[model samples]
Target: MSSAHALMLQGAARSARLLEETQAQWRASGDDLLLFAYGSLIWRPDFEVEQALPARVQGYHRVLRMRSRVNRGSPEAPGLVLALVSGGSCRGLVYRVARHDAEAVLTALWAREMPTGVYDPKWLVCDTPHGPVRALGFTLSRRSANWCGALSDSELLHIFQHARGRYGTTLDYLLRTVDGLRAHGIRDRELERQARLAAAHGLCTPTI
Candidate 1:
């Protein structure tokens, strides 16, 4: 494996710690364990969930700003992924897991989302049709090494055209996210704009 890939595998301890702390917090609340899903998780949750609800979280919005060096790209040609950054509000889904199965479910979730420790998993207040719930969300800080900041249109186009990892190309990932959000009745104009731009540049078929 590449040194970068090896380093990514080194986050197991951190993932375990975060999972432990989150479980403790959930236990203290004495409620069903809630997890907020955005991007790929919205469409392809690999874990079992007792319930899923459309939810929105304030004080954070989704952005295609995190650098993906493994799943969607590589060390030599990193790709972009969605992350919840500060400000505005985000519409997504909240998944509830029974307390009896929370530990196994969260452990698998951390393995999927926390490898390399790029996201900060936190409990955020999510507003749903039923009511408000505190759900664990994976957020990215601007100060993180994986933050991509604001990239120019040309730069994004290049990544979309060239970056690919074990999972697939960057453009495919973007298209999937757009479709996933649309399926859930959530429209992110910025994501739609990106899809349009990619199509115009012949990176992939038009999705918007």
Candidate 2:
């Protein structure tokens, strides 16, 4: 594997260790879980409860960072995919769930996000109203027809623009992300720029 990939694996390993250590806390919390969202989840929260205000964390960036050919709309129809961009910050939303209810919440989230198998679930640290919360989030699916390390702003914007999902319009996605990010006191230069563009141009993503 490439050094970057190896490093990611190592990071993921360390993250696993952290989770292993935190398992009890996770279980004791009535099955509470945190979710880190960058795309549609920024808006829908996948029918999960809005437990707290959104927040941000360093070390992970958002992009068209993955592939999807199975669950989402077909490429012939908007053809949206995920990108694996790094080295920048991402500003998005976060969700909190009671431990006992996590499975139901995440299952629904994964179903909606992985409709075309473009992403994988992961645990991410989130800045929460009460400090930090560990969230279960998803990255692009490893199994996909069109997934990549990078995508054009326009390309990603297209997915964002054509934001129709099981929930609401892509515009709702952009608006909620922008608003949530601002609410969290988190600011990503690129995301902010995009949000501005979305506002000026009437939302970068549109409902499918």
- Maximum-lDDT candidate: 1
Query: Which parts of model 2 have CA positions greater than 4 angstroms off?
Result: 1-30, 46-50, 64-73, 81-93, 127-131, 141-145, 152-176, 183-186, 195-208
Clashes (backbone N, CA, C under 3 Å), per candidate, total 0, 33
lDDT for each candidate structure? 0.88, 0.53
lDDT string for model 2 (29-106, tens) is 565676666655654454646475566656667653443333333334343333323344455666666766765665
Candidate 1 Cα RMSD after full superposition onto the native fold (Å)? 2.2
lDDT of candidate 1 over 43-115, digit per residue (tens): 8888788999999999999999899987888889999889999999999999998988887887788777776
Q: Model 1 compared with the native: what TM-score?
A: 0.92
How many angstroms is residue 98 displaced in model 2 relative to the true structure, after the best TM-score fit?
A: 1.8
TM-score of 2: 0.57
* Every model: Cα RMSD to truth: 2.2, 8.1
